[model samples]
Target: MIKVGIVGGTGYTGVELLRLLANHPSVEVQVITSRSEEGIAVADMFPNLRGHFDLCFTVPDVDRLAECDVVFFATPHGVAMSMAPDLIRRGVRVIDLGADFRIKDVSLWSQWYKLEHTCPDLVEMAVYGLPEVNRQQITDAQLIACPGCYPTATQLGFLPLLEQGLIDHRRLIADCKSGVSGAGRGASVGALLCETSESMKAYAVAGHRHLPEIRQGLSEAAGRPVGLTFVPHLTPMIRGIHSTLYATLKDPKDGLQSLFEERYKDEPFVDVMPEGSHPETRSVKGANTCRISVFRPQNDDTVVVLSVIDNLVKGAAGQAVQNMNIMFGLDEASGLGIVGLMP
Candidate 1:
């Protein structure tokens, strides 16, 4: 069994990791750290994990974390870059569920995050942990930087077309909407009940942090620079992300549906819904599933694809554990076999 440790166990992503890991047959949660909630039982912070994990959270210690076979950094952006280096030096594997090591360019990471990277050399060794595009790299990687929630949904929506050169890369527009939980479990005034309830608005229209990550992924897939007009919105719901992607098709006669189906035929998590099918956020809620549907939108030159996923699941924690399973040579969907929560 692979022994695992999680740093920053008080947040949404941390608990979600425990939720999925609780049922993992070949993995054990050996250590969990929460600087603020140290000594508090993890079950107290999350009643859902009452019987699964009876362990209390601890403060992060690199030496202790290095003892585990794998450590998951569920902390803020800068924490992992500092901690992962020591862990990696000790031959311990790491998966960061933050933005620290996602971008290859340390300057871009610093510019977007507004902090100088503490471990820029390790950035070259960290794999971008999107299993669909970088599965082999993830399996062999010592360090993994999981993609951000918005980028996860947006990239998956655009990856197939961009990789196959089916779309006009220069005119890509991704308009994404995510629930409140995407903001995290912090006590921000903007996320309060009154402020978020019965209201919806777009906050980062100019430039969000996920912009660079999305651009990087698409650029890699297209083998060239791909322009993007990425706009993210905050919805009133608690979970899920729905992205509408618009790109002009290079060939008006090429069947978009057939192209998407053929591209994703081998993928387990990405589900291409039948032609003309509009997928709902609830349809993929609480599962590591990305449901996508394609349309021509009255013009053969333009293709619109709708992608939906539980932002907290496929977009974050579930994907993290998925990366862990792949790294450990286990089935990618082992403990993540949650079906959508349908009413």
Candidate 2:
């Protein structure tokens, strides 16, 4: 069994990781850390995991974490960079579900995250953990940078078109809406039930942090820097992301559907819905799957694609587990055969 240690188990992502890894056939949760919640039983904090995990939250210790085969940092951005270097030196593989190692350019990452990176070398060495885009790199990487919820949904929705050159890379628009859980489990007035319910409004139009990450991935796929207008909104729901993307068709590509189908035919998690279908966020809720469908209304020069994912699943913890599976040579679906929850 792969012995696993998790840092910062107080947030939504951390708990979600515990929930998924508990059922993994080849995984054993060895240590979990939380400065504030130290000594508390995992079940006391999350009732859903009552019987599965008998472990308790403890304060983080590098020596203890280094003993595990792999360590997952479910903490915020700066936390991982501060500690991951030590773990990696001790021969432990590291996976960060934060913004620390996701961006290649250290300066840009600092500007957006407002924290100077402590390990620029690791930033360059870390593999962007989008399994569909960098599966091979992940298998050999000691440090994996998992993509954020917005970047995951956005990049998957745009990759097929950009790779096939079916759309004008110079012009792209991503209008996305996400559940409040994307805000994390922190205490904030903006995330209060009264504040978010019965209303929806876009935030960070001036340029969100995920903009550069998305651009970096899209640019990599298109083989050049691409222009993208990414706008994100907070919906009243609990846990999903719906990305509606737009692009100008380069020339009436007849096989856009076939292109997408072929591109993701063998992918275990990305499901390409039939042409003209509109995928629903609820259909992918709690599952590590991105269901996508394409449309060309009136056969016009414009193309629209709808993509949906459970933000906490394919968007965060579940994706981290998928990367872990690849890194350890385990079946990609080892503990991730989750059926989406429906109403």
Candidate 3:
């Protein structure tokens, strides 16, 4: 069995990781760390895990984590970078579900995240953990940097167009909305039920942190620098991201649907819906899948693509487990055969 260790096991992402790993046939969760919640039983905090895990939360200890075959950092930014170098030196694979090593430019990452990066060298070495985009790199990487919730949905929506060089990369736009859980499992007056239950508002219009990450990925796909306008909104629901992407088509072609279908036909987690389908966020809720649809509105030069994903699943924890599966040569769908949750 692959021994696993998790750092910061109290947040929504952490517990979500625990929930998925508990059922993995080849995985044995060894250590789960939470500085503030140390000594508390894991099941006591999240009743859903009661019968699966009997372990207690422990404080973050690098030595204990290094003993495991792989360690996942589901903590906030900066927590993973502080200890990743040591773990990697000890020959342990590392996966970070934060913003630490996602961006290639350390200076830009620091400017957006507001903390100086601890390991600048690893920034270049860490593979971006999008299985559809970097599956081969992830298979041989020791450090994996998972994409954020908004970036996951937005990038998947825009990828097919950019890859074909059919869109004007300079005019790409992503108008995305996410559920309140995307804010993380934290206490904030703004996140209170009364404040968020019935309202929707857009934030980070001027400059959101995920902007640079999304731009980097799209630029790489277009083989040039991409000019994108990304705006994120908070919706009234709880666990998904819906990204409505707009791009000006350089060539008015009739094969847009075929383009998307062929591009993602073999990708396990990306579902390119039928020609006229509008995918809903709830369709992908609680599952590690991105449901996407493409359209040329009015048959004009403008194209619109819709993408949806469960922020905590395809966006965070579930993707982390997917990366772990790839790195360890296990079946990519071994512990991730989760059907979407619905009413």
Candidate 4:
């Protein structure tokens, strides 16, 4: 069995990892650290994991983490970079669920995160863990940099159009809405029930951190630098992301639906819905699936694509587990065979 260690088990993503791994036949949770919640039973903190894990939160120790086959850093940005280097040298694979090694340029990452990157050299080798695009790289990578939630939904929505060079890459717009859980488990005045419910507003219009990451991925697919306008919003719900993407069709492709279907035909988690069908966020709640649909309203040049995913599932922990499955050569769908939670 693949031994796994999770750093920072108190947060949403950390516990989410344990929740999924609990049923994974090929993996075992060996260590889970939380300096703040040390000595507390993990199940006691997150009752949802009551019967799954008998482990407790402990302080992060490199020796203990290095003993595992792979270490998942579900902590804040800086925490992973500081500790990943040591664990990596000990032959332990490192997968960062934070933005520590996502952006290739150290300076750009520093600018967005407001902290100097402690281990910039590792950035070059950290394979971006987007299974749809970088599955091959992720299979043999020593370090994995999982994509952000907004980026995952937005990129999946725009990838087909950009890949075929059928759209105006220079005039792309992604208006995304995410639930409060994307803000993390921290105590934030903006994330309170009274503060966020019955309210919706777009933030980071000028520039969001995920902007660069999205641009980089699209630019790579388009084979040129892409000009994009990405705007993200905070929705009232607590578990999903809905991305409405717009782009001008430069080539006026004949089979847009077929194109999207063909591209993701072999991908396990990407579901390209039938023509004219709208994918809903709740349809993928608690499931590691990105449901998408394409539209060409008015038979005009402007094409619209809608994408939805559970912000905490396909957008975060679920995707992280998917990457782990690939890294260990197990069934890609193992432990991820989850159904959507509907009301």
Candidate 5:
């Protein structure tokens, strides 16, 4: 079994990783680190893993982690870049579920993340870890950059159009709504139960960090510079992301449904619902599934697409595990072939 280590394992994504990897047959959870919760029993912090993981949180020791077959950084944006370089040099495969290695341009990443990147050299080497688009690169990469929640949902919703040159890349807009858990397990006033329980509002509308990340992915698919107008909203729910994307169709011939179906024909995680079907976020909850449906407005030439994913699963931990499976030549669905739980 491949030994795995997770840095910053007390956070939502980290615990989510622990939940999934604990049962992963081909891999073993060797270590889970948490600076704040060091020396505390992980099960005490999250009772959900009581019997499964009896381990305690520890400090991040690079040497000890390097001994593992693979290491995952589920920390904040700047934390991974500082640690990934050292881990990669020790011949350890690293997958970062943070923004550190996701953006190819260090300058742009720094501008949005508000922190200077300590390792620019690794930026070019880190492969974007969207399995459907960058599968081969991920298989050969030592460092994989798992996508952001917003970007993952948005990119998957629109990639088929961009790949087929069916949309006007210059005029792309993404309006994504995510549950409160997407903000992480922090004690922010904005994320309090009373505050977000029954309200729905948009935050970071003008300059959300995911904007550039989405553009980068779309630009790569389009093979040209693409601009995006993105707005992110916080829904009152607990664990899903729904992205409604709009783009002008260059040619209305293939349209939305046919284009999406053709593009994701071989993808295991993505399920393109039938034409005119609407996918509910709860339908994809607790699983690494991205359900998509497309609609072409009768009068307008704009294509409307809806994409839903479990923010913590396909959006974070599950995707990180998916990258790990790809890097190790295991089936991408090795430990992730779980069906969604629907209410």
Candidate 6:
């Protein structure tokens, strides 16, 4: 069994990790840390985990974490970088679900995240944990930086077009909307029910942190720097991301559907829906899946792709588990064999 430790077990992503890892046949969740909630039973804090986990929350301890085969940092950005170096030296694989090591360029990461990177050297060694793009790298990585929720949906929507050199990379646009739960399990005036409910608005229009991460991935795929306008909105729901991507087609082709279908045919998590289909975020709720659809309206030069995923599942915890599966040579779908929760 792969011994797993999760740091910061109180947040949405952290608890989500617990919910999924609890069922993984090959995984044993040994350590779950939460500095503020030390000694509190994990199930007491989150009733959803009452039966699955009988562990109590402990303070973040490097020694205990390093003893595990893999440590998943579901904490904020800076939290992982500070502890990762020690854990990595102890031969423990580190997977960060935050933005600590996702961007290769430390300066760019610092610019957006507004904090200096503690382990810039490790940033170079950290692999972006998007199985569809970096499956091979993730398998051998000592440090895996899981992609953000928005980047996951947006990148998957645009990857096939960019990789095939079929779209104009300069004018790419990702108009994405996410549920309130994406804001994290924090007490905030903006995230309050009275504030977010019955309302939809965009934030980070100037430049969201995920912009650089998305551009970095697409640029690497396109073999050239790509320009993207990424705007994120907060919806009234609880757990999902819907990204409507737009790009100009270099040529009006007939096989766009084939291109997407063929690109994700072998990928276990990415579902390329039928042509003219619009993927809904609820379709992927509680499941680690990205449902995608490709379209070229009126046979114009513009191609639109719709991608949906549960922000906490495929976006954070589920994808983190997927990376752990690859790192440990287990089946990629080992712990994530769950269907979306639909009504």
Q: Which stretches of candidate 6 lie over 4 Å from their true place?
A: none
Backbone Cα, N, C clashes tallied per candidate:
0, 0, 0, 0, 0, 0
Listed in order, each prediction's TM-score against the native is 0.98, 0.99, 0.99, 0.99, 0.98, 0.99
Candidate 6: residue pairs that collide: none
Task: Report the C-alpha lDDT of model 1 over 1-343, residue by residue, as the tens digit.
Answer: 9999999888888888898899989988999999898899998889999899989999898888988999998888889888888899899999999999989988987889999999888889989999989999999999999888888888888888898898889889999999999999999999998998999898889999999999999999999999999999999999999999999988877477888898789888999999889999999889999999989877668888899998888888999999998998998889998999986
After TM-score superposition, the amount by which residue 331's alpha carbon in candidate 3 deviates from its true location, in angstroms, is 0.9
Residue-level lDDT tens digits of model 5 in 8-114: 99889999998898788898788999988899998899999998887889999999999998999999888988888889999999999999988888889889999
Clashing pairs in 1: none
* Residues forming the 10-long window of minimal summed lDDT in candidate 1: 249-258
lDDT of 5: 0.91
The candidate 2 region of ten consecutive residues with least summed lDDT is 250-259
* Global lDDT scores for all candidate models: 0.90, 0.95, 0.94, 0.93, 0.91, 0.94
In candidate 3, what residue range of length 10 has the lowest lDDT sum?
Answer: 334-343
On residues 1-343, what C-alpha lDDT tens digit does candidate 6 reach at each position?
8899999999999999999998899988999999899999999999888889989999999999988999999998899999999999999999999999999999999999999988899999999999999999999999999999999999999999999999998999999999999989889999999999899999999999899999999999999999999999999999999999999999897999999999999999999998788889888999999999999999999999999999999999999999999999999999899999877
Give the lDDT of residue 216 in candidate 4.
Answer: 85
Per-residue lDDT of 1-343 in model 3, one digit per residue for the tens?
9999999999999999998998999999999999999999999999999899999999999999999999999999999999999999999999999999999999999999999998999999999999999999999999999999999998888898898899999999999999999998989988889999989999989999999999999999999999999999999999999999999999897999999899999988999999899999889888999999999989999999999999999999999999999999999988999999885
lDDT of 4 at 47: 89
Q: Deviation in angstroms for 157 in model 5?
A: 1.2
Q: Go through the candidates in order and give the C-alpha RMSD of each one to the true structure.
A: 0.9, 0.7, 0.6, 0.8, 1.1, 0.7
